[model samples]
Target: MTLPMQVPIPGLPARVRIHEVGPRDGLQNEKATVPTAVKADFVRRLAEAGLTTVEATSFVHPEWVPQLADAEELFPQVAALPVALPVLVPNERGLDRALALGARRVAVFASATESFAKANLNRTVDESLAMFAPVVARAKAAGVHVRGYLSMCFGDPWEGAVPVPRVVRVCRALLDLGCDELSLGDTIGVATPGHVTALLDELTGQGVPVDAVGVHFHDTYGQALANTLAALQRGVTTVDASAGGLGGCPFAKSATGNLATEDLVWMLRGLGVETGVDLDRLVATSVWMAAHLNRPSPSRTVRALSPTHHQEQ
Candidate 1:
């Protein structure tokens, strides 16, 4: 498919809100569990670097994600950090756990396809949405803001390309369920610029306010940055990213990390968009996290700026 050339949008907002998911979404798939102190410190550094919204941890079952087994302890430590720290709760049990730990914000997720929903949560789409109703109500009653996630919005690994209507349906359900905002995810990183534009256009046409939506893209095929630009042009002001470009879906086998926070900030700043994040500090944090994980960063900008062995000479 032929893609349109990206045209920079003029007169856009000077700053954008970046919801950092590194601590939770970013590390969930890692084989080694990050220490609680290390995780808490990572979050503190992120806040110190001007990240206001950070996903601190997931309150899912330890058996499902052993990496976050310390959620109970981790949440309390980070919750006192004086920032907007949200945790992902998969169901009522997770929500109850988060509430007991004094979580201020909670996120619930639903997949756009039957195959993905079953694979990721072992429930059908309707069933997942049904489970969120009481969770959202309980969260609202507790004076907590609830964020909804629609995974595999662009394509699913098992089912291939998903239809626009399906994505819209799931998004509408989440919004109707009283989520403060809904984040649409390119779960497998299969979205191109055209696909993103088309989806946003349809969603907007359906009367879903642009401000109520956020975009989450993966770099699996290297299209994440391009897709992000497309979303911005369409007036999406909120974005989901991970520090050091960490995270991928356990269900989407070949998926890569979420779009890197540094790369996104670099591009946004170049376009005169404000993300309220310090690029240099974020780069430093990414480097630290990558070292802790003992893996190379997936951020292109970070890799380019760092001196290689040849450069050191």
Candidate 2:
């Protein structure tokens, strides 16, 4: 019901494409199983709210993430949506599952540190990359878009601050493996604006195009927006966010929820950056999801704008 005054910022991209991760990354770690139909509706609502790219679900084994076990059943439900629906694929098997469902876009998760590699993927950093190489290649061969998710780019709970060179090396490897783009992740939310700038600078210096990069920051330290601003200032136009701030790393205890889409949209709107999203519709969608999850929305913008906020007050 309220909007921030438009104030254009110099040196930022004119338009940003938000890669909404609510249905998949957001709900993947829920303690209880979210019904398949509900998940499908969530994706539809998000698309209706003008989110052009919504990650639908992951094809990881059910044992690894029971919350997304319905990927098979869920993908078909929302596959007809006009927006881009990307699915996460752990390996070739996961990619196979996604391909079977005619998924056009898929993502592979990688860790920048060995500790997280072992903790999350049960492999060394190289080993995990090796496992993903074939999957990326096949996805590319199938004419499907691929996104590589590099986690713990800023700080790792087990390894402490990750080196810029180390992150760059893994990023280059993912790009070499045929990934169309990479989402740099601050899984623990420990990144500051300076850290974000340094990483982007290093990546750009190492020949990683800024336009091919996306940022995925968590809110553990309340720095998601700041970190995102840094990325935007560096010319990155793709950002990963979840509705209602609904996900955390199941493998990394220190990790928290991904950056909130409503929060990001609010900031972008104020900055006069076009995201092609309807702020009112987006807030309402998050509020409806919060009701389904039986928890208040963690996004400040969602809470401030939702009609229920006044009712509760």
Best by TM-score: 2
Candidate 2 structure quality by residue, lDDT tens digits, 1-313: 7899999989999999999998988898789899999999999999999999999999999999999999999999999999999999999999999999999999999999999999989999999999998998999999999999999999999789999999999999999998999999999999999999999999999999998999999999999999999999999999999998889888988888989999999999999999999988988888888878888888888877775763553
Measured against the true structure, the TM-scores of the candidates, in listed sequence, are 0.94, 0.98
Task: Note the Cα lDDT for every prediction shown.
Answer: 0.88, 0.93
Who wins the lDDT comparison?
A: 2
Candidate 1 lDDT over 1-313, as tens digits, reads 1112334468566668999999999999787899999999999999988899999999999988899999998887877787899999999999999999889899998999999899888899999999899999999988999999999999988889999999999999998898999999999999999999999999999999999999999998999989988888888889999998899976678788999998888787777776678777787788888888887787877776564512332
- Candidate 2 is scored at a TM of 0.98
Candidate 1 lands at a TM-score of 0.94
Model 2 steric clash pairs? none
- Runs of candidate 1 with Cα error greater than 4 angstroms are 1-8, 308-313
RMSD values for the candidates in order, in angstroms, are 4.2, 1.2
Compute the lDDT of residue 125 as modeled in candidate 1: 98
Hey, what RMSD does candidate 2 come out at?
1.2
